[model samples]
Target: MIDKQIIDSFKNLIDGLDVDEVYKKAIVDFMDTYDGNNTNEFYSMLVAVSGLLVELKDLRIVEHGYNLIEEESEKTQDELDSIIRQFKDLNDGKLPPDPMVSTLEEDQVTD
Candidate 1:
């Protein structure tokens, strides 16, 4: 009984209510860099993302789930960085240095 366009517009309005500017920008950036030729990586990421969406829906965290994910990630990163800095402060300057990089002292000693 409802107009098709009206129904479609209402659906879009509901679907887009939670999507803000940052989400739009992220989608644009990701799509801009997406490699269509790599079907394997594409499907892997697709499955992972879809699974997360389903889980979020099951948990009733549908609309605000995206914000929660980012907030939790940032909080985790900050905590990890604090721990790393504490370890570095307690230990010498060589507390878990990058294995891939060669320091000047090491390079000189190797020669």
Candidate 2:
């Protein structure tokens, strides 16, 4: 069985592999500021897990026959926004933007 830390590290590494310079920077910036010990690495794990969830959902869409990316994106965004709000609410309502990097941007960076 893969260790949680190893999984997390791999996730973080994948998350940081975004091609779009700006998006890559955004994700990295968040991970960089993340307080791993504060909430048992909740924020960091949230980012990684959320991303993996999106990918898995996408795969299901491709294999199981569904076109729910738009709907799923909205729902996911809502949840992410709420999480951002939680951090902001605890920190005087100031919040950063999305932490996930765009695959389009990453592809562009690669090409």
Candidate 3:
């Protein structure tokens, strides 16, 4: 009854999307509160949005979900790497470890 091609197609689509981190976080949150049944519109929408979490459990669907999760994890890693890189100072090799605090004395000295 389940269409393998359909599931595979959906998985490919999700895998190619740039929406992995949010998708993973959303899915985890949804699962944390999921009741193994769909009674709320929110849950239905959450599942519907993800090719992996769709209302099917066929092999193709599983593959799609797997690909989606893999892509998302990769994307998340890339984003984290970029963010970390952004904070590095190439010239000085220094990065702000905490919020900066300015006082009246500092301003007066500049003036």
Candidate 4:
């Protein structure tokens, strides 16, 4: 299953991107439709969507001759890189175990 940490990281990465509020919302809404059991497919979809957002931002800057927000493009790219790294760590079994999982296990034991 796709873990909660990955979902939260993806949300943060999307929020950090230089996109319009409407577009961002749309992206998040679309992400919600994915089945969390398939981590590889989800990661691939996220990469594609992130690339599209970057391309759109770059196009906007070119068409308008100035960035809508200072350093937005660079910031978005950096966040994307971070998100990708997290995904890799997760796939390699390098990510720390989720705290909630441990908490739940404790609760079950006590019950």
Question: Which candidate tops TM-score?
Answer: 4
Using alpha carbons, what is the TM-score of model 2?
Answer: 0.27
lDDT of 4 by residue, 1-111 (tens): 887777878988898888898888987887777567778888888888889999999898796765545467888798778767777888898874543242335567642
User: Candidate 1 residues 78-111, lDDT tens each?
Assistant: 9778767767765775545434343448576542
Candidate 1, residue 10: lDDT: 34
Candidate 2 per-residue lDDT over residues 35-55, each given as its tens digit:
555565655566775686567
How far out, in Å, is residue 51 in model 2?
Answer: 2.0
Question: Per-residue lDDT tens digits of candidate 3, residues 63-102?
Answer: 8999999999999899778656655543367765654444
The candidate with the higher lDDT, 1 or 4, is: 4
Clashing pairs in 3: none
Ranking by lDDT: 4, 2, 3, 1
- TM-score, cand. 1: 0.31
Q: Residue 47, candidate 4: how far off, in angstroms?
A: 0.5
Candidate 4 C-alpha RMSD relative to the actual structure: 25.1
What ranking emerges by TM-score with the best candidate at the front?
4, 1, 3, 2
**Which regions of candidate 4 deviate over 4 angstroms?**
66-111
Which structure among the candidates has the greatest lDDT?
4
Instruction: Kindly report the root-mean-square deviation of model 1 from the true structure over all alpha carbons.
Output: 18.6
